[model samples]
Target: MKRSIKRLVAFVFLFLALNNTTAQSIPDSLAQKIDKLFSQWNNPNTPGCAIGVVRNDSLIYAKGYGMANLEYGIPITPETIFHMASVSKQFTAYSIVLLARQGKLRLDDDIHQYLPWFPDLKEKITIRHLLNHTSGIRDQWQLLAIAGTRLDDVITQDHIVKILSKQQALNFKPGEKYSYSNSGFTMLAEIVKAVTGQSLRRFTDSAIFKPLGMKQTHFHDDYTEIEKNRAYSYQRKNLFTFSNSVLSYSNAGATSLFTNINDLSKWVMNFYTPVAGTAADIDQLVQKGKLNNGVELNYALGISSDTYKGYKQYSHSGGDAGFRTYLTVLPELKMGFMVFSNLAEVNTYEKTYQLVDLFIKDTSAKVNADIRMDSSRAIIKDEGRAKNFTGDFISEDGAQFSFVLRNRKLYWERYGNSDLLYPGLKDSFTVARSPEIKFVFSTTPGKSVLVNQYWPDNKRLLVKYATDSIQTDNQLQMYAGLYYCPELDCKYTIVAKDHELILTSNKYNDSKLKLVGKDHLFTDYWWMRHLKTISGNNKKIIGFEVNDGRIMHLRFNKIQ
Candidate 1:
């Protein structure tokens, strides 16, 4: 009886010691608040996330919210591995930085030096351009999609090289613009192979992951390779269903990264503490891109440098198949936040920031609200001036937009989709759906310009070209037919019904074409913005090329 009483007393003391240790690690109140924030995801039947918070290079809080694999009823833990998607870019960028540090390659060296088989295209695209995503190379996935390969297809590096090599044009001149191109990073991975005589996966495993003590982290280059504790990705279309990533893991640059929150915490700490590379090497990794006009872009080598709630944030987000991820670091504050989700529905971007806010103290600052109503009360709406603003405007990068005054309302049309603009104060107009997006028109004749006042400090100006008109029925009918793009291995059908033209593709839903220019067609979809008619022998309507933000001119031949 005395021995039993002594054992009970020891058990009570041990429990108290553990409770004190937990309180010391993180306040119980703070831990509860974090738990409540993710309470919605705390379900065993649903796939969820593993999150971690770092304070001064140490993981202070790490937890798993829901099931990692619903099929087996496995709960998500900090060790559950997930596909990182585009978040893999930073690691790929680090590989290039290491190469530069070793004096094997220079960032300013032309990419053709490493990739001799690559088409010249008369552009001086350097390694730095590729790292910063300013190379202006068309996105690889879009190129593959145009070439008849879907995003979910098993595409290898060789497939990407073959498709990109055949391309005769670029989206723009290198360093001329800042458009995120995954093709550049793919090329960077190839460059690493050429210089180091090692695959990107093998090289990073030794240099970055191993040195940083990220045992669970590696460039996932082989889908067939078995990994323990891997969380299966899932998507809910009609119901929650298991969906395997169809993308080939052989490619190691743009995507194809698998890691867990615990392993990623070590990598996050490496950003603040030097272990894998020198300070100079890390500096190169975070250096922002520069445009030809000497303007600096927000995108650094593989990451993006931006501000969040007045705190400087170096961050990146990733989405592929059913995986969604977010990683943000505040170097100044020595704080970092990471969220890895296997479920597509999880808004990791917003949720990760909310997690960051939980740890960081809020300043209670607010943005000054714009008083549009008070500013416009005394101003009379000018119909004549609005009508005079009707004209096609083109940007330096060839993005065209048109202003049309119809039924006493001004509509801003770009590519073919029209957005009705409501008068704000003077020549400024705001989109009803997006009041933050303002269209300010220049009042001076012959100097009329349409400024898209979005993305503060990065506003784009569209110069007036000439008055544009809609296409006639005859012109629309001539181009109507079944069109086949041999590259995309896809067919597009144009149907004329009720004096309106409709574009139908097997991959996407039917969209009505709006004539934006003589040969340019626009649709309500933002991605299908640039559709240009292509002519065959004897100037007969043959097909059209679809080009947009990421895709370049992909031609479709006329058939039937």
Candidate 2:
């Protein structure tokens, strides 16, 4: 009788929830609610976001909050220009698609066929691979930062090409997996120039902007070129927010898009209506990516496809320097959302969903921001078992982390931060702070023992390794030397001081390193976190490869 009563109550709650989500708000109230959602940034003294709502073929609503230029007291409006960062990717992708339609280049052709300067990584990288971000090329920004190139130090398109041309390896075999690499898009832009004898900005101007009548939209290839009524970006700091922006990017393809919500609303409308490309060309834009092993990915050509609240959706977001941008399209409802901000702290993705809930009349209850509570759960405890999982670990895709036994408890450690791990079912554990993450340890047959990790976005198999406590002073000296990476055009010197290792670079502070099992290394520095010693045939340490999250196995050879 109790079970029957519980089931009845559950059904009643579900019906109520569905009805709540289905409820419709009046147009006036919806607008007011949307404004209230952005009330935090509605002040005149702060940096803010410009929003646009397009329903079907028409832009029904458009507004901006806060200041565009805090120094000048310039109020933000729908016409305020924003650097659309990666949201500019779709335009780059569409340009490639249009070129294919014109018989200028085939999508399946190898990238090397056009740009002969790029090194042969012994894999076929097609234009399609570049478009879908499955080419396994390292991200350009990661490569640059690893090489000690300051982002604010006048980076140009030619510089990107120069750096990418010398890349010695791939993150993975082309089409083997999907990794978002900005280098792929930069190469795509290079392909456009190589084939059409015109820059991406020039080609896109003629092919897309002109046809759509988007006069305010253009790729800001030259950062020096100033546009009228442009918003000055800002970074949040304790010493006041003004004078903090110093982004000089003279590049196209991957980023450097200058646009306004009014101009961007037209681009959002282009996805559903006959605004930019033909019907057939438009069909190619939303096709999802597929890996070699037949696993379909959410990433499409320059955009991503997913379902939100039972409604099929397409979206893409971008962030560079102090700029943030997000664009979303729900084709079922023929509705689109655009949020572009000039401040680094602006949560554009968060604002997009809040606007979505209001404009789409969503009924889901609000989540408490101050409290983080997991569903009903408890952890099992054992001291000996916790100690067994303690060690440095690395995933197959080059993700590095460690587990430490502290005060009779196991804690997950990565990049100098440690999270207490709670014991669970035998050989299983959950993170104390993030209960959603689970780790299971087991011994496999023959050669491999695995720590199976389940996180929000990925599931990885990590293998434990021992630290370099076994290495003597003589062994540590072998790794000491000055090294150079031709691809990054940067130099690094590894120093051995009193049997300890320290990495010194001209543009960066010294980072203390911890050697791991055999050839691997761990460091606190962002770029040098995961390093593996490159060994010569004569059993001498020749160089090392770095894996800094997005860029994998970047070679830094011994110079001395």
Candidate 3:
């Protein structure tokens, strides 16, 4: 009887081992879906993408879609290396937290403690502020462009400091608000250098990447250095044309880390298993925090913590000139999803959210069919008369915008930015680095132009443009002073300069605007050109609004 029982037990064990091996294998259904998605992305007009999905610390899916290099006809694969833009933030943040764990530095320490050549901006910004994006530092990318820095030029941490030192003021008081600032993270990368006496890349590689067994990941600076299985970045112009653009690796903190999904799966496992750093260090990395005065903040060091579709989600996204990527983890389910694309055609956030929603809400159901619209052809339009829509339209939230008539076409401009003229779309225009927006004009005859605005990601709004002259009075003057939104942590100083309304933000020097109506002004700036004021009582402007759902009220006192 004992011999029979031992033989039965061995047979059962063997059957279970084979069953587990089969389960670990990629299912045919999933493989087919991956193939379909890759085919869609691989179209000559679409940007190439790399995707990675981890299930319980194992990479269940790691594949590349589209061409990494169109010129070479090189096909992307799971091993292809793509630039992980802001996704590098988490690693940089982890390095800082690791150093803090080792008694090398403190999060609350002022940035000047390590780099004293910083600007004298009155506010004592700490490393915590940098991590949480509460430091009101202007973006170095804008500064670089303004200073005539080339896109391909190599910029170091010290170069960023030199630009910051010349800046006159912060966007707001340090730690007063939370705004996404790549400049803050870049500075942290420099601080990692100053504190550890080693390059940020070297330290991260030795301390984190190596220890985590992420052998395929490296800090990339030059595109010429050939790495094994690196994917070429592509920009899909249409269905048949793609352009090969230079992959950005010059910026390390804000961008420039080459990696693959196979490695990222292991990296995600570290969140729960704690590989290179201690469990305590991992906790610190994901620890939630609020401001000193008790304002809730969503960002933790490098990762953004939020609840999505009934799951606690920690994730970050990266986008450069030609590439886009996302890394998200659901600790409750012990599952993580990452998608990297050489082309920037797909919205990683929307796609990932939809997939997670499908899995959590109804695993048996497929993703919504309407969610799969071709984004390239989607354009918003205004239904009103072309001549009436030619006035300035400002955002109620203080972003300046403009609309002009040139060659019978309506052109849209933002914040002293240049007008993007649409020759045929009537009320629709496209902005650079942004999705297309359209204006639907109201049917009111002989009245000011009122139109609905449509944005990408399925947001819509109605906007009114005044054709009459703006009332110049004391009340309007009171609202004219510089207003700042502490929540957004951005400042807009509205001053009447040289007979034109001037709206100035920290990023741009300032733009001159022509006040064409009661609550509207026009400029030629690239990002924002229209300015609209929201009135409260007695036709008095109480707050300003922008097209991007940002509202700055009259309550924020003038800086002077």
Candidate 4:
């Protein structure tokens, strides 16, 4: 009778535990609303995303929307594998940290100790610098673009290494500033190769993916290797149609991770609970980077340490070709959210934020701080006078922006994106997206007034660049010349064609130049935009320099 009573008590406790779990389960209404959030992509024709929400060890919500392959009419599911772009970095980082734990490599050790092929750029670049993106290396993509290599081409690991070998300069002193460079992560992959006899793909497979039971995840090194249920990426051609965004990357470390929502949930849950790695290792992975001067950086090893709606959050976003992926983890709440898309136009970060709002309450600090900053700005009451700010402006660093008057509001424009500019202090203004960044207009009595951009960390002065003065064909013809860059061993010839300067590069592609100001020009090339003409002692055009923000001054000499 006593043994039977004990059994009955145990059964009753189990029943109550199950009941409690059911009680805490998400409401059907809430789950339906979540379904409604992704209902737009629940069609046969559209490329969609796989969304996953993890609470502690359980993936409470896991769903896929839209077609994985439009040609075969295969709808997306949690099991479908998708190529993760820069989101691949986190895995590479974990591999490196695991290696460090094994005493195979040290994070503080100079990268030269492992990869001797990398040039010594006067400063000692540590392994930490590469992981933190503080290595002062110029971005591999930009370097390839400047050298006339198309991104859509089959760019391999060897090609990146070859290009990096040819680079004779660094972006800045190592660990001096935080500049995001995909090249650094690729170098980290090389270091792994040098330290260990295995390739990054093989190492990560044995060390991370397999151990975590992440069967769907791998560092996709072989582009030709066919996998079952692989999803194709697409971009919106218009509101009515879509086009394929081809990604031919045999590259690893920096990108080329293939995973699914189900597999990714396991990884996210591991961040909160020790499933594959120890809690101490996760602590090391999430630790923020510090500069040479000890200024803490927001970027940790691979992920970014930041806040969302006033809560401490660790997150990262990836974009390559048409693949958009975002993973955010709130360890305190034991919650993780991820949105992986096969479409370029999908704002995964914003969508994840919207989804998380259903579970996490808003913290007042981040929102209030933003409001205080905006509220402190002096507003412009007069619309007529705002027109004076509408003009092209170029920073001393060769970065260019334009101020335009649109619908009686002042906007700061760059590339194709625009942000509203609100007046701040005396002759100062703040951008809508970045309130801390102020464009303070200053005039030294008789000198031409310039806008001094005061960012939280750095300052840059920008001068007005008038495009109206060069209205004649004669003015355009004078800037036409032949220039040669020794770094890439390529020559560029400029010819005046139909009131515009047409550029023909010998080594790569070419584009027409748009005149910005005297002896200055811009181009359609995204990486290397500015073409500032250099003059000799005889007042003749000697060369031109292209500064794409990262690469400060790359000079192309006049050969003919």
Per-prediction TM-score to the true structure, in the order listed: 0.80, 0.81, 0.65, 0.84
Across 286-393, the per-residue lDDT of candidate 2 in tens digits comes to 888787877778888899987776777889999988899999998878899888888888889998988887766543356554545343333335667566677888
Question: Candidate 2: how many backbone clashes?
Answer: 0
The backbone clash count of each candidate, in order, is 6, 0, 41, 0
CA shift of 463, model 3, Å: 15
Scored against the true structure, residue 287 in model 1 reaches a CA lDDT of 83
The Cα local distance difference test for each model comes to 0.78, 0.81, 0.66, 0.81
How do the residues 1-560 of candidate 3 rate in per-residue lDDT, one tens digit apiece? Answer: 99998787566544532322112246677656655655566433344666667777687766665556666545566677778888988999999999998899999998999878776678899999889877867666655543445454667656666776666666557776666788888788889889988878899999999998899997775555778777666666777687775654455776788888778888888887778898788778877656656766668888898666667778999887677888998877778887787776768776665545434553233546443433333332432456666665544433445666654445676656654443334444444334365555554566645556654322233445555654565434655676654433456677764445676766666777666546555556533444556666676665564322211121333454
lDDT of 4 by residue, 258-306 (tens): 9998788888888878767788888889899988877788899999987
Best by TM-score: 4
Candidate 2 at residue 301, lDDT? 86
What does the lDDT come to for candidate 1? 0.78
Task: Rank all candidate structures by their TM-score, best first, as comma-separated numbers.
Answer: 4, 2, 1, 3
